[model samples]
Target: MTTPVLEARGLSRAFGHVLALDDADFEVYPGEVTALIGDNGAGKSTLVKALSGNLAVDSGEIKFAGEPIQLTSPTQASALGIETVYQDLALAPHLDPVQNMYLGRELMRGGLGGAVGLMNVNEMRSQSRVAFDELGATVRSLTTPVGSMSGGQRQAVAIARAVHWANKVVFLDEPTAALGVRQTKNVLETIRRVRDKGIAVVFISHSMPHVMEVSDRVQVLRLGHRAAVLDAKHTNMEELVGLMTGASTKGAA
Candidate 1:
């Protein structure tokens, strides 16, 4: 078996009197899509946050590439090549695609222009275009504010940005939520493209059809812990629902 690119063993987190995660175990391998499915308050968000360095775990171990590491901050996670796209799709409404792609990391020209704080707009635009094209994201106008773009287009930009910066794994939270049929199709296609490039994708959503349609494996969370992990091909919706609802504890091979 391939070593998991990201793994969490006995992960736990608490918020005041609430336990958001309780010994949650999870893993995602390279070049495959892993669906993270659970009902409300199942600890999916808490687990993702701990793995992505947005939130520290109360007790557990996170292994990356067979070595243990501390995820103290999102920047630390980014440095280790892990990226997350939250459900909110945190893109700047007033900025264009190219600008949004770079955000705080805009390339600056060398010498005088660099000292004068001039951004290398042309270079950034060229690379942003390549990233979008590589991800097959159709952004008709690269110069328009992303807020004005369609939902599908905005989602594409978010995924492309995450993939561009992430070399190992990318966590996507409810990527297709509230999207129309055509838009969801486009987003799912982009996800496949990302996986084909050898990055592990952690897809978290409540949509069973989408989970079955796009995932190679399904990891179900119940209450505050992982209920089971099953091969997507060998599992059915009823079984998944059973696991999530604690009606069944047996896991599929």
Candidate 2:
């Protein structure tokens, strides 16, 4: 069997006296979408923060590509090919897709010491276009600033940016939260594309239908601890909800 792309064992975190995450065990496999679902204050965000290196874990182990890793910062996670796209969609509204895609990690023609020192705008644009195309995104102009795009378009840009840079896993927080039906479909399709490309995806969402539609497995968290994990094919929304609410015991295989 192929090893998991990202795995967390005995993951725990706390804020002051409040335990935000408790012994959360999660695993994501290449080319698969794993939905992390829970109600408000269920520790989904906390788990994500720890997994993405935005917050330190009190005790736990994270293994990427089957090897133990210490992720101290978001940059460290990115360096290890772990990219996270939060609900806020962190794009500069004033910048175009290409610029936003390459925001901090802009491609330069050469190092500062090199004779040719210049930003590679053309290279960034070309790559951004390729990334969007791969996801079947309908961004007419890579030159159009993100603020001018619709919410779905902005979400697409964020996902595209992650795909362009991430080599291992991607974490998406509430990807379709406020998107219209069509826009949500677009975003979901882009997620499918990401999974098809052999990238492990940890999708966090509250919409049960969306979770059932796109996820291979569903993991439910309640009060900072894992409630259950169920196979999407084998469970229904009611069952999932029940598990999340501590009313049922069945879970994903």
Report every candidate's CA lDDT: 0.91, 0.88
lDDT of 2 by residue, 190-236 (tens): 88888888888889999999999999988898878888878899989
Per-residue C-alpha lDDT of model 1 across residues 1-253, encoded as one tens digit per residue? 9999999988989899999998889999999999999999999988998999999998999999989989999989998899999988899989999998998788999999999999999999999999988877888889999999988889988988999999999999999997899878887887888899999999999999999999999999987888889999999999999998988898432
**lDDT of prediction 1:** 0.91
Q: How does candidate 1 fare on TM-score?
A: 0.96
Task: Report, for all candidates in order, the number of backbone clashes.
Answer: 0, 3
Give residue 228's error in model 2 in angstroms: 1.3
Q: What is the TM-score of each predicted model, taking all chains together?
A: 0.96, 0.94
Return the TM-score for candidate 2, rounded to 2 decimals.
0.94
Can you tell me which runs of candidate 1 are displaced by over 4 Å? 251-253
